[model samples]
Target chain A: MADTIDARIWRGGADGRFETFSVPRRASQTVLDVVTYIQRKLDPTLSYRFACRVGMCGSCAMTVNGKPRWTCRTHVARLEDGPLTVEPLRNLPRIKDLAADMAPFFDKWAKAGGRFVPSTDAEADFAIVEPASAERRAADAGIECIGCAVCYSACDLVSWNPDYLGPAALNRAWTLVNDVRDAGNADRLDAVAGDAGCHACHSQQSCREHCPKSLNPTASIAGLKRATLRAAWKGGP
Target chain B: MKLRARAETLLWGAQRASAAVLAVCVLAHLATILYAVRGGLTAAEILSRTRGSFALAFFYGLFVLAVAVHAPVGLRAILRETFGWRGVPLDLGTAAFAGFLVWFGWRAVAGLFA
Candidate 1:
């Protein structure tokens, strides 16, 4: 706790600039720790969002040194720069002081029909699905998203084309696409296809590289492309 | 002739389609020379045979026009996409290239007719 670390956290409204804070650096101190220390001890009014400090909640994501990351798991020592400069995630509407508005980000998930729609009613017989099956395997690979908005912030396509469904939402839709029990697979596939959806993704692989969970959204998007193309061809042109 | 961004895409599609046509035309032209000149066909004999072939002349002329339009538009996009820069200099260069393709290809196509 002897070393003095300079922290620059984004402060104020949508048009705000970086507000600087200097604090005593501690051993094994995560970025979330430093931010918490500044808010609690230095300034009580400083605003930031975090639920679970252990990184499962996916709420502490902020851009560290121009790259989106889960600040809860990111160590202050690992950042190579002299001072850690924190900014709100890019391509999302900023609220104030490191917290960006996630409504649009999450709304696209609904618009993409990412939620599961059950096929059977209350009295229907249970359908058994093998965990080793191809559909189940595809779902297993992409179902770990905690809605952190990291992939959404990392995608350049989202920055360029604001209407694009983004990686996380599309990834969720892909998982649903493989769910044989879901009644809305065809509608979901049709919704996630075409220009403003997964087709617009240039395979930049930014989301793949930045996901803290190491989940590959590109593979899921590619799967959706193949499925949609096959479905489109089989049914008609 | 339109300059909208959407028009650019259509022009690019046309250019690509034309290049495919030119590729076939070029191979056919080379193969025709190789096969037809086996018996040392004279210049007079070549003219006599080519003069009546309006069908061959039209097809070759279409190939010539395609090269004229395709070469310049592709160079235009290449300059913009690769250099990370775009404006008057790039546009002028593309226009000049199109003019060059049209002039050279048309000269050849006209000679085939006359």
Candidate 2:
């Protein structure tokens, strides 16, 4: 194995270009480790975002070799074919070197009704939801998303339409839609039903393909389509 | 805005429903053509089979309507995403395109039927 690996990392915003640095390679070293090494040893000025190095927080997601991935989990061995090129996630404004602004991403989430509206007040008893039920199963299928925005970055439609809700938000809405305890069904359907909502998705399955959790937002979007169609036709939502 | 949101969902549903119809219509049309052309029929022979046939007229008419519904909605999406066109003018243009499809398609069907 080569003693050192060439690391080409994005160093600025919008018009920013890639800058290459050489880092010592170690066994079982991850992409995040390489970046951290460069930031600590080679260039303290190099900027990036990461909290949990174990991939739980999902704060360390970046574009690895032109695809969105969790750099904390992406091993150096898997990307050894060429100089590992890392950049901030796509379809978002760059804040700085390797850091994309997440305001638009979270804004779309809010627009999609990603937040759950509680049906019961504090005095009310806990709602019993069966894990085996169809609705609960559907919700559970998409509930593991850690807000990584990998699916959002993978979505081509988001790049085309700025107003698009993207995959993560739609997936969040799907879980809420299927939740029996959620009181936001009608309004949530309305939120995700329109031109920039679930209807805008191209059903290309790019979100499903690139999700680190393997959650299928395309299926969730399809469910929203069906739900929204019923709501529109029957004059419910 | 609320009306447009409701209309968007309905439009999406209409496009999908029309697509299902189109799938069947396209397959049946293709099958008919392959069957008719297998032994090589002359122009007169083809016209004789199609002219004054209620079944062919009905099938082709429905096919034309489905295409009229399906194509322009797809075009609306394309235009909105590609050219950033929206609202009244874009909807009007897409409806006009649908009308053109209906006129052009029905005229051809009428030629064979009449």
Candidate 3:
């Protein structure tokens, strides 16, 4: 077996090109380790992002061999036979080598009204939500999303429609929509009801297929679609 | 002017509803065509069965209208996403396509009745 892996990484902004580095392969090596070796041992200026080096932060997501995945968890053994191609997430502006500008991604979340609007005062008692209730379960299903843009990068709709709210934003909205304690339902529905919102998702399930947390943003978006329809029909937001 | 959120939601709902109608209509239309041609029926025979039958005419009329409603809405989403074309012109263009679909579809259906 070959002891070295070829890592071809994107090395600049929008006009950047891929730069290849050969790193010594070891047992149980991850894509992130390969990148770290190249940055620390080979070149000092190779830029990327990662935190919590486990699967929790979701900041280590990158396009590995043309598929969006968390580099911290993506072992090199899973890749097909070729040089490992690592690039920044797609459908976003690249800032540097392997670093995508996340402003658009986060902006969509705000635009979709992903923030929870507080309806209670500080002196108020904690709202009790039954854990087994349908709404709570639905909210729980998508609540673990770490804001990783893997789903966004994988979404074909986002690629085609640059203004799309993307999966993360819609999923955030969906979780909130189902939250009984959340006071932002009406405004969130209004925000996600339009062309750039939940209506724009084509149900491609690319987001569902690529999410590191196994969250189905596609289903969340469908929930948003239904919720928005009722809200829009009632003319309430 | 800001888009009417309710109207946009209704548009999405209409597209889905029309799509549901199209699914049934398309299957029934195809099955009818297959059944009509199965015994090697002549063109005159086919026309004879459809020409004066109010039931067949109504079914086809509904089918045509469903297609007219369904296709243009789907095309509207496609045009906006793929071509980056939106606003009044895109809406008007899809509406025109719907009109054209209805006209052409009814003309073909009407030929059988004629």
Candidate 4:
């Protein structure tokens, strides 16, 4: 193992260039640690975002060696020996050196009806849903999404079609679609249909491939496709 | 918005349905070609077997219809995603392409049947 690792980090906004820094190699050091060292020790002006320094926050996701990953969880030892290149997540507006504008990502999430709507008021009796029901199980398959936008950055369709809701949002919608207690299926289905929605997905499976949580947004999008088709067959929702 | 969504979904359904049909039609067509060619049959010999054959006409007609339906819908998506083309113009263009495919394909099928 080399005593130092050469890292090329993106600097500035959309017009930024990668600036190289020699970061000290440490055992079990993650990619996030390299960025942190660059910010704290090398160049104080370098900007990035992270919280918890763990995989849970999902804020530390970036394009590492041309792949979107949670930097906090990506160990340098696991990567092949080469100069590390990190950049802001693709398909989103660049905010700074390593942070991307999350507004569009969240906007699409809202457009996909990621938020849950209640079937009954709080005063009403609690709705009982079977945990082992087919719908529940299907929803559980993709419910572990951390909203990291990693899947969004990894998606090719998102880059092609700006209006695409991408994987994470559609995955969230799928979970809501199967929520027996939720009453937003009609609007949610409408939101996730059409050219910019689940129909746009080419089933490339990039979302499923790059998701750090091992969630399958591609499966969720497939569910949305079926749901939308059924809804369309029955006429407008 | 709802109408557009419904239309897009219906197109998606058409694309998938046509693709499934094409899958079976293509495999059968390929297998038939391989079987027919094994005997070193000439073009005229192949035409003699196909001409006035109701089974060939029906199968080939279905194949043409599936291709007409499937290709245009996929092309529409490609035009939109790759070239940023959309709206009624794109829709009309792809629809016309489908019509052309149907016309051209059916003409060939008709020739085989005749």
Instruction: Tell me the native contact fraction for each prediction.
Output: 0.00, 0.60, 0.65, 0.68
**Number of the top-ranking candidate, with DockQ as the measure:** 4
lDDT: which is higher, 2 or 3? Answer: 2
DockQ, all candidates in order = 0.07, 0.62, 0.54, 0.64
CA shift of A135, model 4, Å: 1.0
Q: Largest lDDT belongs to which candidate?
A: 4
Q: Lowest lDDT 10-mer window, candidate 3 chain B?
A: B1-10
The TM-score of candidate 4 is 0.96
Q: How do all the candidates rank in terms of DockQ, highest first?
A: 4, 2, 3, 1
Q: Clashing residue pairs in candidate 3, if any?
A: none
Question: Model 4, residue A81: displacement in angstroms?
Answer: 0.5
Decide which is better by TM-score, 1 or 2: 2
**lDDT of each residue in A157-176, candidate 3, tens digit only:** 88888888999999999998
Better of 1 and 4 by lDDT: 4
TM-score of chain A of each: 0.96, 0.98, 0.98, 0.98
Q: Which stretches of candidate 2 lie over 4 Å from their true place?
A: none
Better of 2 and 4 by TM-score: 2
Q: Return the TM-score for each candidate structure.
A: 0.71, 0.97, 0.94, 0.96
The CAPRI quality class of candidate 4 comes to medium
